[model samples]
Target: MPFFVYGTLRPGEHNHDLFLRARTRSEEPGRMRGLVLYEGPGYPYAVEEPGGAVSGDIVTALPETYRELLAALDELEEYAPGDPRNLYERVARDAVRADGATVVRAWVYVAAPAVAARLRAEGRPIEDGDWRGPGDSRTHRRG
Candidate 1:
Protein backbone atom coordinates (compact mmCIF):
# COMPACT_ATOMS: atom_id res chain seq x y z
CA MET A 1 0.00 0.00 0.00
CA PRO A 2 1.10 3.56 -0.67
CA PHE A 3 1.25 6.15 2.09
CA PHE A 4 2.18 9.81 2.47
CA VAL A 5 4.54 11.15 5.13
CA TYR A 6 5.61 14.72 5.84
CA GLY A 7 7.37 14.59 9.16
CA THR A 8 9.63 12.40 11.31
CA LEU A 9 8.79 9.34 9.26
CA ARG A 10 10.03 11.03 6.09
CA PRO A 11 13.22 9.87 4.42
CA GLY A 12 16.31 10.81 6.49
CA GLU A 13 14.06 12.06 9.27
CA HIS A 14 14.07 10.53 12.76
CA ASN A 15 11.87 7.49 12.17
CA HIS A 16 12.31 6.68 8.50
CA ASP A 17 14.75 3.81 8.60
CA LEU A 18 13.37 2.40 11.82
CA PHE A 19 9.91 1.98 10.30
CA LEU A 20 9.68 2.54 6.58
CA ARG A 21 12.96 2.18 4.72
CA ALA A 22 13.36 -1.55 4.94
CA ARG A 23 9.69 -2.22 4.52
CA THR A 24 9.05 -0.04 1.50
CA ARG A 25 9.12 -1.11 -2.10
CA SER A 26 9.59 2.37 -3.60
CA GLU A 27 9.66 6.02 -2.60
CA GLU A 28 9.08 9.34 -4.30
CA PRO A 29 8.63 12.98 -3.46
CA GLY A 30 5.06 14.23 -3.58
CA ARG A 31 2.70 16.86 -2.28
CA MET A 32 -0.71 16.69 -0.61
CA ARG A 33 -3.02 19.63 -0.84
CA GLY A 34 -5.34 21.04 1.82
CA LEU A 35 -3.24 20.59 4.97
CA VAL A 36 -1.24 23.00 7.05
CA LEU A 37 1.84 22.05 9.02
CA TYR A 38 2.25 22.82 12.69
CA GLU A 39 5.42 22.35 14.64
CA GLY A 40 4.87 20.14 17.67
CA PRO A 41 7.09 19.68 20.72
CA GLY A 42 9.47 17.39 18.88
CA TYR A 43 7.65 16.87 15.64
CA PRO A 44 5.23 18.46 13.19
CA TYR A 45 1.51 17.82 12.85
CA ALA A 46 -0.52 17.86 9.63
CA VAL A 47 -3.67 19.87 10.10
CA GLU A 48 -6.15 20.24 7.32
CA GLU A 49 -6.82 23.74 5.99
CA PRO A 50 -8.48 25.08 2.86
CA GLY A 51 -6.02 25.88 0.06
CA GLY A 52 -3.19 24.38 2.11
CA ALA A 53 -0.59 21.97 0.82
CA VAL A 54 2.00 19.65 2.35
CA SER A 55 5.17 18.48 0.66
CA GLY A 56 6.16 14.93 1.54
CA ASP A 57 7.22 11.52 0.43
CA ILE A 58 5.01 8.93 -1.21
CA VAL A 59 6.09 5.54 0.07
CA THR A 60 4.94 2.24 -1.31
CA ALA A 61 5.28 -0.55 1.20
CA LEU A 62 6.02 -4.10 0.18
CA PRO A 63 2.87 -6.17 0.17
CA GLU A 64 4.17 -8.60 2.79
CA THR A 65 5.06 -5.77 5.17
CA TYR A 66 1.93 -3.70 4.72
CA ARG A 67 -0.08 -4.86 7.73
CA GLU A 68 2.87 -4.97 10.10
CA LEU A 69 4.03 -1.55 8.92
CA LEU A 70 0.63 0.06 9.38
CA ALA A 71 0.34 -1.41 12.86
CA ALA A 72 3.71 -0.07 13.85
CA LEU A 73 2.98 3.37 12.43
CA ASP A 74 -0.40 3.46 14.19
CA GLU A 75 1.34 2.78 17.47
CA LEU A 76 4.05 5.33 16.80
CA GLU A 77 1.48 7.97 15.95
CA GLU A 78 -0.74 6.95 18.88
CA TYR A 79 -3.64 6.16 16.58
CA ALA A 80 -6.07 3.55 17.86
CA PRO A 81 -9.12 2.95 15.67
CA GLY A 82 -11.68 4.34 18.11
CA ASP A 83 -9.40 5.76 20.76
CA PRO A 84 -9.84 9.35 21.85
CA ARG A 85 -6.12 9.71 22.32
CA ASN A 86 -5.63 9.42 18.62
CA LEU A 87 -3.79 12.50 17.46
CA TYR A 88 -3.58 11.60 13.82
CA GLU A 89 -6.09 9.94 11.56
CA ARG A 90 -4.89 7.60 8.85
CA VAL A 91 -6.61 8.36 5.56
CA ALA A 92 -6.36 8.17 1.80
CA ARG A 93 -5.70 11.24 -0.32
CA ASP A 94 -4.34 12.12 -3.71
CA ALA A 95 -0.67 13.09 -3.98
CA VAL A 96 1.06 14.78 -6.87
CA ARG A 97 4.53 13.52 -7.62
CA ALA A 98 7.52 15.81 -7.69
CA ASP A 99 7.55 15.83 -11.45
CA GLY A 100 4.20 17.56 -11.22
CA ALA A 101 2.56 15.13 -13.58
CA THR A 102 1.67 11.90 -11.88
CA VAL A 103 -0.97 11.45 -9.24
CA VAL A 104 -1.38 8.66 -6.76
CA ARG A 105 -3.85 7.79 -4.05
CA ALA A 106 -1.88 7.37 -0.85
CA TRP A 107 -2.68 7.01 2.79
CA VAL A 108 -1.96 10.09 4.90
CA TYR A 109 -2.12 10.85 8.61
CA VAL A 110 -3.93 14.03 9.49
CA ALA A 111 -4.39 15.80 12.77
CA ALA A 112 -7.78 15.51 14.39
CA PRO A 113 -9.51 18.92 14.49
CA ALA A 114 -9.38 19.20 18.27
CA VAL A 115 -5.71 18.35 18.32
CA ALA A 116 -5.14 20.79 15.51
CA ALA A 117 -6.71 23.54 17.53
CA ARG A 118 -4.54 22.71 20.52
CA LEU A 119 -1.39 22.70 18.46
CA ARG A 120 -2.45 25.89 16.76
CA ALA A 121 -2.73 27.60 20.11
CA GLU A 122 0.64 26.35 21.30
CA GLY A 123 2.88 25.73 18.31
CA ARG A 124 4.14 27.71 15.38
CA PRO A 125 2.33 27.22 12.11
CA ILE A 126 4.48 26.29 9.12
CA GLU A 127 2.82 28.45 6.51
CA ASP A 128 5.04 27.10 3.79
CA GLY A 129 3.62 23.57 3.97
CA ASP A 130 7.00 21.86 3.91
CA TRP A 131 8.27 20.14 7.06
CA ARG A 132 11.85 19.59 5.94
CA GLY A 133 14.99 21.78 5.84
CA PRO A 134 15.94 24.35 8.48
CA GLY A 135 12.35 25.23 9.15
CA ASP A 136 11.97 21.98 11.05
CA SER A 137 14.15 22.31 14.10
CA ARG A 138 12.53 19.32 15.75
CA THR A 139 14.27 16.94 13.38
CA HIS A 140 17.43 15.23 14.60
CA ARG A 141 19.89 13.34 12.46
CA ARG A 142 20.70 9.67 12.97
CA GLY A 143 24.15 8.92 14.33
Candidate 2:
Protein backbone atom coordinates (compact mmCIF):
# COMPACT_ATOMS: atom_id res chain seq x y z
CA MET A 1 0.00 0.00 0.00
CA PRO A 2 1.12 3.57 -0.59
CA PHE A 3 1.05 6.30 2.01
CA PHE A 4 1.25 10.01 1.33
CA VAL A 5 3.46 12.02 3.64
CA TYR A 6 3.44 15.80 3.71
CA GLY A 7 5.28 16.81 6.81
CA THR A 8 8.12 15.33 8.87
CA LEU A 9 7.66 11.98 7.22
CA ARG A 10 9.06 13.31 3.95
CA PRO A 11 12.57 12.10 3.02
CA GLY A 12 15.54 13.62 4.91
CA GLU A 13 13.22 14.84 7.65
CA HIS A 14 13.85 13.54 11.15
CA ASN A 15 11.08 10.94 11.12
CA HIS A 16 11.48 9.58 7.61
CA ASP A 17 14.53 7.37 8.05
CA LEU A 18 13.29 5.99 11.34
CA PHE A 19 9.70 5.43 10.24
CA LEU A 20 9.37 5.14 6.48
CA ARG A 21 12.76 4.71 4.79
CA ALA A 22 13.44 1.02 5.32
CA ARG A 23 9.80 0.23 5.79
CA THR A 24 8.84 1.54 2.39
CA ARG A 25 9.72 -0.19 -0.84
CA SER A 26 9.72 2.96 -2.95
CA GLU A 27 8.93 6.66 -2.89
CA GLU A 28 7.99 9.42 -5.31
CA PRO A 29 7.00 13.02 -5.07
CA GLY A 30 3.23 13.54 -4.93
CA ARG A 31 0.51 16.00 -4.07
CA MET A 32 -2.92 15.80 -2.47
CA ARG A 33 -5.82 18.14 -3.11
CA GLY A 34 -8.43 19.82 -0.89
CA LEU A 35 -6.27 20.05 2.23
CA VAL A 36 -4.85 23.02 4.07
CA LEU A 37 -1.72 22.88 6.20
CA TYR A 38 -1.01 24.58 9.49
CA GLU A 39 2.26 24.96 11.37
CA GLY A 40 2.08 22.84 14.48
CA PRO A 41 4.42 22.93 17.44
CA GLY A 42 7.06 20.75 15.83
CA TYR A 43 5.19 19.65 12.74
CA PRO A 44 2.53 20.82 10.36
CA TYR A 45 -1.04 19.55 10.34
CA ALA A 46 -3.26 19.02 7.30
CA VAL A 47 -7.00 19.59 7.23
CA GLU A 48 -9.72 19.57 4.61
CA GLU A 49 -10.15 22.70 2.53
CA PRO A 50 -11.68 23.28 -0.86
CA GLY A 51 -9.29 24.52 -3.53
CA GLY A 52 -6.28 23.57 -1.40
CA ALA A 53 -3.43 21.27 -2.21
CA VAL A 54 -0.58 19.76 -0.23
CA SER A 55 2.80 18.81 -1.69
CA GLY A 56 4.52 15.68 -0.47
CA ASP A 57 5.68 12.17 -1.36
CA ILE A 58 3.99 8.83 -1.81
CA VAL A 59 5.77 5.96 -0.08
CA THR A 60 5.02 2.42 -1.16
CA ALA A 61 5.38 -0.36 1.37
CA LEU A 62 5.38 -4.11 1.12
CA PRO A 63 2.05 -5.60 2.06
CA GLU A 64 3.59 -7.52 4.93
CA THR A 65 5.12 -4.36 6.36
CA TYR A 66 2.11 -2.14 5.89
CA ARG A 67 0.63 -2.77 9.31
CA GLU A 68 3.88 -2.06 11.10
CA LEU A 69 4.54 1.02 9.02
CA LEU A 70 1.14 2.46 9.83
CA ALA A 71 1.59 1.65 13.49
CA ALA A 72 4.90 3.47 13.70
CA LEU A 73 3.55 6.51 11.88
CA ASP A 74 0.39 6.58 13.99
CA GLU A 75 2.50 6.56 17.12
CA LEU A 76 4.82 9.26 15.81
CA GLU A 77 1.86 11.41 14.89
CA GLU A 78 0.11 10.81 18.24
CA TYR A 79 -2.80 9.16 16.55
CA ALA A 80 -4.33 6.14 18.29
CA PRO A 81 -6.95 4.30 16.33
CA GLY A 82 -10.51 5.37 17.22
CA ASP A 83 -9.22 7.78 19.82
CA PRO A 84 -11.43 10.82 20.22
CA ARG A 85 -8.60 13.20 20.96
CA ASN A 86 -6.19 12.11 18.29
CA LEU A 87 -3.87 14.87 17.23
CA TYR A 88 -4.01 13.54 13.71
CA GLU A 89 -6.40 11.28 11.93
CA ARG A 90 -5.24 8.69 9.44
CA VAL A 91 -7.34 8.58 6.30
CA ALA A 92 -7.04 7.44 2.71
CA ARG A 93 -6.91 10.07 0.01
CA ASP A 94 -6.08 10.50 -3.65
CA ALA A 95 -2.44 11.33 -4.37
CA VAL A 96 -1.18 12.63 -7.69
CA ARG A 97 2.38 12.60 -8.90
CA ALA A 98 4.12 15.95 -8.79
CA ASP A 99 3.86 16.12 -12.54
CA GLY A 100 0.12 15.45 -12.25
CA ALA A 101 0.53 12.36 -14.34
CA THR A 102 -1.27 9.84 -12.17
CA VAL A 103 -3.38 9.51 -9.06
CA VAL A 104 -3.56 6.75 -6.50
CA ARG A 105 -5.28 5.99 -3.25
CA ALA A 106 -2.90 6.57 -0.36
CA TRP A 107 -3.19 6.86 3.40
CA VAL A 108 -2.69 10.35 4.77
CA TYR A 109 -2.70 11.91 8.21
CA VAL A 110 -5.02 14.86 8.53
CA ALA A 111 -5.81 16.99 11.50
CA ALA A 112 -9.46 17.46 12.41
CA PRO A 113 -10.97 20.73 11.30
CA ALA A 114 -11.46 22.06 14.85
CA VAL A 115 -7.91 21.22 15.80
CA ALA A 116 -6.49 22.75 12.68
CA ALA A 117 -8.48 25.91 13.19
CA ARG A 118 -7.23 26.17 16.75
CA LEU A 119 -3.65 25.71 15.66
CA ARG A 120 -4.02 28.25 12.93
CA ALA A 121 -5.46 30.75 15.37
CA GLU A 122 -2.56 30.32 17.75
CA GLY A 123 0.31 29.79 15.35
CA ARG A 124 0.27 30.07 11.58
CA PRO A 125 -1.40 28.43 8.64
CA ILE A 126 0.94 27.24 5.90
CA GLU A 127 -0.88 29.28 3.27
CA ASP A 128 0.85 27.52 0.42
CA GLY A 129 -0.27 24.13 1.72
CA ASP A 130 3.28 22.76 1.63
CA TRP A 131 5.31 21.64 4.64
CA ARG A 132 9.03 21.08 4.25
CA GLY A 133 9.95 20.16 7.87
CA PRO A 134 10.77 21.61 11.26
CA GLY A 135 14.46 22.08 10.51
CA ASP A 136 13.75 24.17 7.45
CA SER A 137 13.56 27.82 8.41
CA ARG A 138 12.41 28.63 4.91
CA THR A 139 8.99 27.23 5.77
CA HIS A 140 7.99 29.80 8.34
CA ARG A 141 7.57 33.45 9.25
CA ARG A 142 8.29 34.66 5.76
CA GLY A 143 8.01 38.29 6.77
lDDT of each: 0.84, 0.81
Off by over 4 Å in 2: 120-123, 133-143
User: How displaced is residue 19 in candidate 1, in Å?
Assistant: 0.4
lDDT score, candidate 2, position 8: 78
TM-score attained by model 1: 0.88
Worst 10 residues of 1 by lDDT: 134-143
lDDT score, candidate 1, position 98: 96
lDDT of 2 by residue, 1-143 (tens): 59998877888777788887667788999899988887777777888778889888899997778898888888888888788788888898899987898999999999965686686578577776777635673353242
| Candidate 1, superposed: residue stretches over 4 Å from native | 134-143
Across 37-143, the per-residue lDDT of candidate 1 in tens digits comes to 88876777898778899888999999999999999999898888877778888888889999998999998999976898887788677877777645454553221
Q: After superposition, how far is residue 86 of candidate 1 from its true place, in Å?
A: 0.9
User: In model 1, what are the clashing residue pairs, if there are any?
Assistant: 34-52
